[model samples]
Target: MRKLLLLILLAAGFLSVRAQDVSLTKGWKLAIGDSAQWASPTYNDQHWQAVNVAQSWEQEGHPGYDGFGWYRIHVVIPSSLKQNAFLKDSLRINLGSVDDNDEVYLNGKLIGRFGGKTGDIKTGSFYGPRTYTIAANNPAILWDKENVLAVRIFDTGGDGGIYGTNFSIGMADVMDHVTVNTEADFNYGERNSLSKSIKLITTNHYDYKGKLAFKVTDPETKAVLYEKTNDAAFSVGRPFTYSFEIARLEKKSYTIVYTFTDEKSGKEITHTETTPYLLTPYPSAKPKINGADVFGARPDHPFLYLIPATGQKPLTYKAQGLPDGLKLDAATGIITGAVAQKGSYPVTLTVSNRLGSKTKSFTIIIGDKIGLTPALGWNSWNAWGLSVDDKKVRISAKAMVDRLSAHGWAYINIDDGWEAEQRQADGKIIANSKFPDMKALTDYVHGLGLRMGIYSSPGPRTCGGFLGSWQHEDQDAQTYGDWGIDYLKYDWCSYSEVTPANPDLPALKKPYQVMRSSLDKINRDIMYSLCQYGWGKVWEWGAEVGGNSWRTTGDIQDTWRSLSSIGFNQDKAAPFSQPGHFNDPDMLVVGKVGWGPSLHNTRLTYDEQYTHISLWSLLSSPLLIGCDMGHLDRFTLNLLTNDEVLAIDQDALGKGASQYLKKEDYQIWVKELKDGGKAIGLFNLSDKYQTISLDKNDPALKGYTKFRDVWQQKYVITTGKDFSAKVAPHGVMLIRVEK
Candidate 1:
């Protein structure tokens, strides 16, 4: 009895397998060459080359001539088979590798066609095969007895061949009998090991309703990783989104398998794909060397890069390590403390994400040392807009070095509008009358121990309509190099018009690629500052395109609102900014009085200006002063020449700017320097003088024991928990703290 039951079960499984094999793969003949009347039911091709089904013309060596070709396959249905066939049957033809494009015909009837050699598809491109389906009811398609099928192809370039794949005729006996396709298109977005999180986007085209189920699985282990079932009867065009978190897995190659099935019909289809996943351990949170103080402070604030783990999100730093006066924020990734005695201390940080957890270890070295503070520089835009002339530029350069060089002011940058038609023809770019002797001017600046910086728009025209380096990228770059131009600020103005508003990044990145390539070819050593004003997150690909610095915000005017607005937008972009390539928030608006073609001269009170500088300094922005250094007032000179304040802006570890206090009209910002010190700025925006206090207990201020006014060169020795100082309206106070 047991053997009989086993036999019955075996018989059922065998019958099921045989039933699926009934699919139409037999009784088909193919022919090559194009004929206008090949689609006619009565068409005859007795003399044409004969070929077997499921074969490509290329495989037979008679791939046919290029340009245009045709393929025909004949199928006959017997009267008995037609009567036994299920209703509403469908036949699918899979044409593999048609040079550029092709059209198909079945039983002397036009079935379907797909264009392959047109548009972005070239004759010899990485294109996949195409599949077309046709209804089986038309009499023109023929029901039985020697039916003919034909396909015409057009190839523009490269080898023209047909690499055919699966071909079949399927039937649907009931609504649930429809086949479920398990194909999905995927695109990977931004990813980083520091934030062990990656975005996986997939587009599904099959009906996932009723008994159909969609599932993602691990191919190696055959583990069901993620799965989803459609509750709604969604149509074939509906798109679904699924976000999955793959936990702590070692760096390795993995396959994502997708399966679709109609449980009611027991019909299913599965597709698998493999992608690389690299897992990197997070960098040590605390510095390895201790006893090092930043910004001339006693016990220095910790300085180090925070490496993200695979799939981890941005860290939320919390204070940790050291004595009661020291703390680090795990959420903000900031370490702060004040030390009476300088010594080395070990530091460690714990990082966690959805994937898993890891600890980073290092040490901080504290010491008393002083080095050449980074220089302050002047940029032309703030003082003179389109009105800048050759004499005006020369005069500014001389003034910056003659009066401010002793104060550590070095580079003299000639912002936009310097490329006057004198340098080149076509009015696109050239040194105009502004600087007839461009080389001489650069030489003169260098002679004064100051570097020279020039500006040009990345577009066809500069913002002032002066000469620009658009298509002439290499030529313009060579011109700058030849003229001994030390720095290049490539602005993106009219270029924005060419850039798509909502760019399909994958499609519209060619222009930027070209520009970057051209710039690198011209001069790789020249500082290439990309000024694409944050369009489509250009910074994401800026570094790859040879940009040393890219703008993270829109064009900024000199105003309290504008400064604060641009300052706040820096948080999302803070991670991408590093040494060599920095985030530029436009130029400074310090000395200028908001006059001329310049945007509103930051109507901010002195205090507000201080806040702006503090924020920019902490943010590690390129300190290219836009004010007139030639006529620097006492107050303006002091603001521009503060060595202690400038040290934070040029910290070796590259600390990011953080807001310690935020108010509508007042604010405080700070930057942790390499040493156990801090660059702090307090600003007063209102007309009335306001007294601001620094809270010792504040997490950002945790590592400071004594305060020194950097701009005034005065020290305030106080161990109190808090300290206060009065700031004049529209004025600012820049300071460094020692622990």
Candidate 2:
């Protein structure tokens, strides 16, 4: 009797294990090219490509394919489970996620379809999870036999397949089909946005009503901080969010417990999660590294790169793969040492606190060449938006050569509105109606002793909605080289539309790498400028991708709010600026900005203009004039022609400025000059006049310093270690200090 009981228990265990969910991972046969006959159940797929279910077709032998394909697999249902309670009630199938869209068929019989010709799928519907119910009495399903499941998938680009975490066949049990998800495992600071949700799913559209109770409490103290109860009803598969206005709680872990009781069956379910939050206000002190993905250093120069990480306190850092002679501070994340090597070193940085830790990978290039100084040029966007024409461009080039080139200015860049509505038959981008001949126009600009710059996107369209160099990167680079183009402003624009969801740094850097390779294949030297609006901290690795300058901020408008926001934010990115790659703060918005057809003086006041020039020059930002040169007034000309001021920007030292001292609305910005001198700008950002002063003994200004007013062209004798002046509202006092 004991032996018989043990056998029965073992049998029951085997049945329970078999009743669990089955994920369709293996045994998938993929047809590379699309065909209507491939969807048939009788089609012979013996010689087809074997592909994994939870992976992109792009990785499985279809590198750049963006079209229709078919995947077939046979899953067997054991005959012994024909009378199983789970299958007898109902069975549900989850196909997971596809790239763009797909149609599912069971043994050549159409069961359901989504995100394609069926008209139910929207643009990004392929990313949505799919779940369908196979009722107990459904005749389409083959129970206790071999079932052939075929899926027809349409991929627009990138990865396409049945992918992600949950692609399985399981029993339909609505009683326990609730899953909870939170935005992050941990939370920090009061400014952080947090979200928590509970997904309620049911089979056969079963209506479920239940009571949900949520409570958040300190694990150690058992003190309730947040508590709420609500009624939850589900007629379909939808996620309901719980409102959590996180308070400024103490820096300690808190447990969130969830309880659910079914209204009909009285079956209770509970789940608990823990999250820790810091109540620090805006501008967190947490450790954070700023700038591009890569940093450049000379072979023999003393390299000092500080990882800009901030947090409350007691934060420790560790670095792996540091080259010889370089050392990192475990407490500060400051890397200092003279680099004598000339190779790329992949360095991993980790910052840990009492709460948790964060890690990031960075590259230190010992020797790479490109940006000698901040680029000085004129872009047509601010003056003429999408109305750029060849005649206007030729005139601008002439002005650069005749008036601006003598003052260390070059690069007459023709911004957006240049490409045609579509690419040529051979996949080459051509000039639009506004610009008749691109090659000839480039030659004209080149012949006038000024280099020419062109604009294009990594995607299909520019910001002006014209054809861009997406898939035709190499062809467009060759065309630009043939036309004598000297620079390329590659914008992000439509590329964001096609980018994968939550694209990693490698994914974001791939397009730039493709364009870099394209440019290297050409003979002409084209300066690459990345315009991804500072996404992914281009400053850290802009040089790695051959970017001479990377946009560190978004597009700059001609308003003070826009200018100040972009200008003042450059302090954190100062250390990343070097000879080959500088942090770009978008185009200048000085002088007269027509933005095409209608011209008006810049909205900035005279004082604001001075502040703008002083800040940009000090920050070592690319000074791209975004105005019509033909309409330059004397004041605007004087503002642009200050060689003394521009000298600080053109300083060979390549050290960007930093706001060393900020007292109230008065800020003191300092930049190291190449000649052992320092350029300082005392700025008043508030309204109304204010008296600003700086201690002459400040490190920015060595003791016993003599100052020269660059804008005024005068010298001021210094006594002791003090300097004070009444600065105009929204104005700057730019001076050079000689130690």
Best by lDDT: 2
| TM-score for candidate 1 | 0.46
CA shift at 345, candidate 2, in angstroms?
29
User: How well is each residue in 1-739 modelled by candidate 1, as lDDT tens digits?
Assistant: 0000011111111111123322334433345445678666566656656554344344345422234555555565444433444434554344433444666666555666555335422232222245554555656544546666566665432234454333433342222222222122122335411111121212334444443244544433567755655432344455333334444443333445444444444444443433333211222343222111222222432222222222235434322354445555565343444455566556555555544555544444444321112224677766666556677767887787545553345567777666655443443355666668888888777656566788876566665555567677767766776776656777654454455543466533455566556645542234566665565576577666656677766445455565766776676665665555567777777765322343222334344555666677778777777765555644456555554555567676665656667787677767666777877778666655578887788876776677887655678776567877776554567778878
Lowest lDDT sum, 10 consecutive residues, model 2, at 1-10
Runs in model 1 deviating more than 4 A are: 1-375, 420-429, 506-513, 522-524, 538-541, 593-603, 661-666, 682-695, 725-733
Angstrom error of the Cα, residue 572, model 1: value is: 3.1
Which regions in candidate 2 have their CA more than 4 angstroms from the true location?
Answer: 1-368
lDDT of 1 at 481: 65
TM-score of each: 0.46, 0.52
For model 2, residues 1-739, the per-residue Cα lDDT tens digits are: 0000011111111111123566676788888666768767688889988887656676587654555688898887553333544325666666655555777888787777766333643233233356665665667677777788888876544345555445666555544344443422232334543344544443335566788788987544568988888988665556555555566655334567877676875655566655433211232345443333455665655454555444455778888998888998786556777677798889998877776676777778876454467777899888887777888888888887665554557678988878887778988778889888888888676555566899988877665557768889999998998887878999866575677854678877888999999988876557789887666777888888888888887556566776887798888788888776788888888877746655556767667788899999998888999898776654566677666787788776778998788777878898987778899999988866677778766666655367898886678775655787777667788899886
Clash totals in order? 77, 23
